[model samples]
Target: MVRGKTEMKRIENTTSRQVTFSKRRGGLLKKAFELSVLCDAEVALIIFSSKGKLYEFSNSSINKTIERYQRSVNEMGIGQKTTSQDNLQHLKEEANYMSEKIELLEASKRRLLGDSLESYTIDELQEVENQLEQSLSKIRATKTQLFKERIRQLKEEEKILAIENAKLREKWDEMQSTQKEIVEVETELFIGLPQPRTTR
Candidate 1:
């Protein structure tokens, strides 16, 4: 049978808790060392115990690493240093470019939505009107073509219906003539027959 899972509450026994902390701390440090070795990375770790004791570990001398960190920070201008002026200039230029792009996109959107055309200069308005007129003319031409095609189809359908109606009328006339001939034959046969014996 499988064992039951444990709850997430802290361990209440001091000895057990201490042992767990020691084991986990060793494991964590070992993993950190392995990561640094495998990835060629510099690693530093600091720890404080409940007794107010301090401990530190570094892949290299602590002083050298700290000096390097300080130099990098100086170059980055983190403490009133003006070393990053070039980077600031580049960022300002990039911001200006982005602002211009945004303005262009907004203007395009406004044009697409037909907003504020009256604010444009007369020359700009004339250009826009010319484009619109061209588009409208194209649309009208397409619509006229479609309407002509539809009318042509309707005319053809009407012609077909008229032909079918003529054929039906011809058939009806033939049927009526046949019926009239049968009636005439029956009348002749009755007249030619000896007159039926007088009723007495």
Candidate 2:
């Protein structure tokens, strides 16, 4: 009698799972070999067991098959030709990626240079406009604050200079009075009048 179909679940018994893994891995390698021999096709198989053991098989030298694959890729002119459907799809994907990158670069350039956003799409232009406005506002605020600070400094300097001027004027007045007293005393000495008893 035929057995029921196996359920799609993990094998519970460790020994049974190991046995199954060994059998299936051998069968898979055997089929790969047979296909390579019967159809003259290159085959390479690599398997890693649950226990992390590595296994590998190749119809010919694995390196040779890899070199052949590389040669085929080069012969196809992988970058130059996009004629096939798969190649065309790949090219389209690349084009989309490049377009996005270009947009990002342009946006960054515009931001750095402080350019207006009139030429781009509405959404992109709006974004740029917002950023520019923000930058301008910040610059204006900083400029205003700097001007106020400069004015305050100038006022303080003026006040200081005014105080210094007042002090210098008072010193000039004192110097003039001392000079006048000295001239009067010299005049008395020259005229040979009875010298007034000078105060000690």
Candidate 3:
């Protein structure tokens, strides 16, 4: 006959509970041994009876297994903490490097802007002097070119004015000669006596 499913409640009778505990504990230990042997797996089991009697089983040395378990757990925690500490150290070092780089850049910027040159070496000062000298030379060359262009323009204007002044002088000389001829003709026609009758 098929057995009915057993309900998983406490057995009410004390004798029955003790009997069940004894039978179940023996069956559990037997299964643990079988599993370890058949699967070649490590197994550990522990039990306490209602009367405080202890029963235990282990495929290997129980103490060694327990120590290994503790170390595994501790290693997980320690590994995470060690990784975090390493990352933090790397970040701190990187930040220090960046800070030093920024300080150097700021000092270089200050030097370019003509500040803090008292500690500069002779070669560095000479470099700055050479740059300024080149700039001044370019500026002077540009100024000289501008002055020459202005002088050329002024000379061209003087030539044009001289040509215009010569034309004006020619016009004035022509006007003066024409006025002198007219005056002489008018004097001869009006102020002279009738001397033409004796000239026959």
What's each prediction's TM-score? Answer: 0.40, 0.37, 0.38
Off-target runs (Cα >4 Å) in candidate 3 are 1-115, 186-200
lDDT of 3: 0.88
* CA RMSD of each candidate after superposition: 21.4, 22.1, 35.4
Local distance difference test scores for all models: 0.81, 0.86, 0.88
37-108 per-residue lDDT for model 3 (tens digits):
999987888898877999999999888778867865897877744467767986999799999999999986
Comparing 2 and 3 on lDDT, the stronger one: 3
Query: Residue 163, candidate 1: how far off, in angstroms?
Result: 1.5
lDDT per residue, candidate 1, 1-200, as tens digits? 99799677788998887787678678878877887899988777677755667766778877877786777688678555554786798689979999999999998668646788878988887777777788899999999999999999999999999999999999999999999998778443344567667785
lDDT of 2 at 140: 100
Tens digit of per-residue lDDT, candidate 2, span 1-200:
99999888999999999998999899999999999999998898889999899998998889977886786688687664435986787689979999999999997987658676456687876777787799899999999999999999999999999999999999999999999998778443255567679788
Top candidate by lDDT:
3
TM-score for predicted model 2 compared with the true structure: 0.37
Rate residue 83 of model 2 by lDDT: 59
Model 3, position 67: C-alpha lDDT score: 84
lDDT of 2 at 114: 62
